[model samples]
Target: MLEEIAIEDLGVIRSARVPLSAGLTVITGETGAGKTMVLTGLGLLMGGKADPGGIRPGAERAVVEGRIDLTRHPEVVGRVDDAGGSVDDDGSVVVVRTVAAGRSRAHLGGRGVPQGVLAEVADELVTVHGQSDQLRLRTPAKQREALDRFAGSEHAEVLSAYRAAWTERAGLRAEIDDLTSRAAERAREAELLRLGLAEVERIDPQPGEDAELTALTSRLGNAEELRQAAQRAHDAVVGLDMETEGSAVHALEQARRSLEAVAEADPALGEQAGRLAEATYLVNDVATELSGYVADLQADPAALETAHQRLAELGTLTRSYGDTVDEVLRWASDAGLRLLDLDDGDDRVTAMRDRVVELDDRLAELATRVTAGRRAASDRLAEAVTAELSGLAMSGARLEVEVRGTEPGPSGADQVAFLLEPHPGAPARPLGKGASGGELSRVMLAVEVALATAGDEPVLPTFVFDEVDAGVGGRAAVEVGRRLAQLARRTQVVVVTHLAQVAAFADAHLVVTKATGGDDVTVTGVQQVAEDDRVRELARMLSGQEDSATARQHALELLESSAVGR
Candidate 1:
């Protein structure tokens, strides 16, 4: 429910902060009072288009803000929590909107939000039924929805089941259509997959094969140079040299004998002679190994040519598939699987068809149950709506819910319409064509009452009625007030009217008044009247002046009667 509304620099409302209660909050004042401005402010806060012309003559901007308590609104609470916004200790949500020259902004829980978000949240919080509510009834879609609402929870359950079934059937039908439409494309894809798999298999590339080939190729290309280098190393380590007196071993042995001759002159020279003898022996063993390596080293041209051919094959695979042997091998593995699937297409399609049939059977069963449930609900709804219409002074009118089968839809397979008869012995027709403006209001009231009592959840938290009492007065106006008050007990309702009887029914009254200063004129102020003041205001509404004795007495009596009922 709305907790408060604050308006500033908006048309005739300069600065006004009006606190609201949870029931039927009424706004009334003189014919030209800024009452309409209050409703406009609400519309703006709900993301309605902002008019730069709505700003006061001397003001640069206009602002409208409202605070709502979500204590009973679990849906809104969950949304706020999901969005990371705060819900106050009392579970109240704050919504604010500001408009300047040509720009506008909205805020929720003090955090900035897009105007669309404000509109979404506002839609969950309120519903206004201004004088134009009668015309809205003329729409066929709305008429259908109203009928559904009156049908209660049974219809909702049926609708839910029907919609689920319809969705599954529709989705499968779409998939089949798509597949049927592209048979040629699928065949082309199958051919491509088969060709790719065969091509890759012909090469049969192995992991790491490319690296092995590269190493072999490098060795073969440098075979002559490698053989020459190996020969030189073998000779340097232990090969006998014809130019020298002897091999390294022989030279070391000659040096050892000389060192032994000098051993007696110094003890350190004796130890060095023994070390040289050991080195000469080790050199002879190494020379034998080097001779073996030199004998084995050779270059084979045929083997080098074979390695070159293998490298070229790998290069082709790299170009078409991957840069490395491992990547090419992986591609081969995946291609094999795709090839198998394409060859077995008929078997795969058969399996999908079997699964689809099973789903279809289950969906059909649910749809049958849904249709039965809707028929039952339609009967109950018609009864409730008819009961409410009697209280709205349409005692002779007949309210009916006409539910019939229709093509599958997101809602259900059932189409519901509301029919009405305005007078006794009159032929019943659709509500849109059978009811007049005043009669539409009465019918709307009946539908609202029936929907509220029948449904498990309320669709809207607030209802706005603009000139609902356009042609009603006396007892009829009082009845309208009574019905509004009853609705207020369940949800907030706001009405804009010039009738004093209607205004007198409000739990809280706000007056809009225009003021002129010097040569400038603007609707810049609003006042909330208290109990005694409200009586005076009502009297003024009744007789156009508070000083009228007859108006004051009647206003006092009205207040008393309203109090007694509460």
Candidate 2:
């Protein structure tokens, strides 16, 4: 619901704050006092197209700000948050739109956002009905939407199922088309994969095999040097080709023997003798192991040549397939799976075709159910709207909700439209054919009331009527007022009206008055009026003179009647 609107340099409204609340709030003024500017300001808040030309003369920019309640609108809150804006803890959001030169900017909760974001959130937060909407209600598509909304969740359930089936069918058809069109391309892909797999199979790469081969080749290439080194170590440790006296083990053994001779006269000497024995055994063990290594090590030219040849072959595989053998092997594994799928494209296409047929049958069944539901709801909606029209002073009126079969879309296979006959012997025709502007207004109002009562609860948070009572007058105007007040019981209502009867039902009344400055600049302001001021405003609406005592008495009676209606 719109809590308040602050408009600056917009049209005749130089700077004005229009406070709104959760009830019927009406804006009224003389013909040129800028009543429509209030709705224009609201349009800006809702992210409507902004014309910089509408800015007040000599003003550099026009700004419109609105405070809206979001307690019943989490989706709107989520959208604002997604746009990097904050909603107040008390469930209110501030939206501001600024128009300067040839461009406009939108801000939500102190954060700049795209105007599109505000428009998207506005859909769930408010519904603005103007004279244009009365014409729109005659169109088949809009009437269908109204019927669906009035049908509530049951028709929605069937429509959802039908659309889901239709989407599945479309997906299957698209896949089939793609498969047929790209059959040759897919075959070429399969052939390429097959060739790559065959090369991989012949090479038979293994994980870490290249690294293992490299180590073996290095050892085989240096076989002679390795053997010479092992023999020299053996000679140093024991007495092979050289003397063991230069070896570390031999030196330690010599020291241990000297210590043992001295310790023989004491207990510590026995421990030193054991240490010399262990050192001699360790030196003998090392010499034996080195001698074995030298015996096993051989420089075989044939084996070395074979290792080099194998490395060259593996190198070819590595360069073409991967930097390493393991990566090449992984590629082969994934390619094999893809190759299987590519080879089975024909079978997959056939499966998809069969599934499409299945979904078509399902969608047809749901469409039939949807049509039935709409036909049943059409009768109920027409009856409710006709009953509402009777109270609006069109006593003999009848609303016919015509449901015709059409090609199925997301909404199902029905085209719904409203046809009205004002009285007996009148041919039932679409809106604007036989209905006047005032009749259209009443019809729309009746439909809104019927729609509101049709649902378990009101859906839109606020409803704005921009001169919807365009051609209505007298009791019909009073009925319009009563209906608006009735709607306000469910949600917030903002009306731009000229009728004192319609204005009488408003819980809050704002009158727009223009003040011309000495500099010849005309500025407009909106002020909430009460008691004597409200009576005067209503009197001005009833008659050209705001101070006429007869008009004031009539205004008083209208207010009294509106209170009694509540």
Candidate 3:
């Protein structure tokens, strides 16, 4: 609910503050007293379009501010926080808007915010109904929402479930399209993988095989030279099968034998003899290993050819998949995993097709239930609103809520609309098309009255009407006032009206009085009036003479009767 609103330097309102209450608050004044400026302030607070012409002459900027109680509206406060703003200490939000000649700015909860942020949050905070809203009532979507709201929780629940199922079905269909659209691409990719795998399998390359084969080929290509070198080294280490050659082992043995003969004469010669014997043993072992190496060396061309052929095969694999045999092996391993994933395409298509079918069935079931609930509620809403129209002095008017089945939407498969027949024997036509301006206004009022029954609905916290009472007077205007008061019981209501009967029903009445200062600047002031002041205001409203005894008495009677009637 809106607690207070302060507007400055906008239109003819140089400065004005309106303190609102729970029930209806009516703003009334003389013709040029700037009564509509209060609603203009509301428009700015709700993030409406700004105009430079609205700036008061010689004023630097025009500003509008509002304090709204969020005790019953935590979600709106949450939105404020989401926009990086904070609420007031009293837990109410402060929304302020300022307009300059060439620019405008908006603030929420004491922090600067984008106008769109205000637009988004204000949608949940207030619903403004005016002459234009009566025109908007003719739209089918609005009609559908109105009927659904009248259907209460049952319709909302069904609609919610239906939307969920519909969304699921849409997602499944998109997935199915994606999978089906890529059939040829998947086939091409799979075939390419198969050919690469076939080439890798034929070669049967191992990790490091390229390096191992290169070493083997190098050794085999020089086998002859390696054998000759091995034979020379063997001959040097041990005595070869040739004359005039003495091996190291033989020399060492002779030295040990000479030292042993001397050891009989000296102990020093005995230690020298032991060292020579150990050297002779080591030399003999080396000679035996060299002899075996020389005999085993073979310069064979066939083995060399096999090694070169294997190296070439590994080269093919390296060029195709990697720079080396080891990297090629890694590529093969990764490709194996990818091949498994690619092979599952057909299976995934089947699964998604099944899911789409399941969602379609569920969507149909939910849509059916939603349509049923909407139809049931449509009857009740039409009956109630039609009765309200009669009470609003459209005695012969009838409201028909038509709920027809259509393709499924987020809400449901039901397309709802309202038609009006102003009297008997007249063909029923859609709301704005059939009704006159006065009838349309009354119809909107009646719909609001009917909607008041939906207290449990999650709707806007406040409703503002800009001259919704236009073209309405007498008993009809009083009925409009009572209905607005009735509507306000569930939420805050502010109406701009010139009807004294409507003003009489307001829990709070504000009068906008404009005066020309010494500088010839027109300044408007808003004052909340009660008791005698309100009566005098009503007297002026009724007969344009506050001091007339007859008007005063009549105004007094209106206040008393309006209070009793409420």
Best by lDDT: 2
Cα lDDT of model 3 by residue, 51-75, tens digit: 8898988889999999988877788
lDDT of 1 at 179: 60
Output the TM-score of candidate 2.
0.82
In model 3, the worst 10-residue window by lDDT is 236-245
Which pairs of residues clash in candidate 3, taking residues 3 or more apart in a chain or in different chains? none
Residue by residue across 42-144, what tens digits does model 2's lDDT show? 8888878889999999899999999998988888888888999999989999999999997999999999988888888877777777655424365787788
Candidate 2 segments whose C-alpha is farther than 4 A from its true place: 81-86, 109-114, 132-139, 222-300, 315-317, 390-398, 419-439, 530-536, 543-553
Q: Quote the positional error of residue 216 for candidate 2 in Å.
A: 3.0
Q: Between candidates 1 and 3, name the one with more favorable TM-score.
A: 1
lDDT of each: 0.74, 0.85, 0.83
Clashing pairs in 2: 263-269
User: How does residue 123 of candidate 3 score in lDDT?
Assistant: 72
Please give, for residues 1-566, the per-residue lDDT of candidate 1 as tens digits.
88888999887778888777877878777766687788888888777778889887788888888888888788888877765667899889887888887788888887787888777776677766554333344565565666666556776666676667667767766766656676677779778767766766777777798898888778778867876776776566555562256456657877888989889999898999999988876776676665675576567688878878877887887888788979888877887786676666656556656767886776667666666766776678778777776666677787777778886566656676778877778888887674566677767776776677665666467777776676777877777777777777778787777777777778878776677756576555667887778878888888888878899999988888876655
Candidate 3 deviant stretches above 4 angstroms? 110-114, 132-138, 186-341, 434-438, 455-457
Q: Candidate 1 or 2, higher TM-score?
A: 2
Predicted structure 3: lDDT:
0.83
Q: What total of clashing residue pairs does each candidate reach?
A: 11, 1, 0
Between candidates 1 and 2, the one scoring higher on lDDT is 2
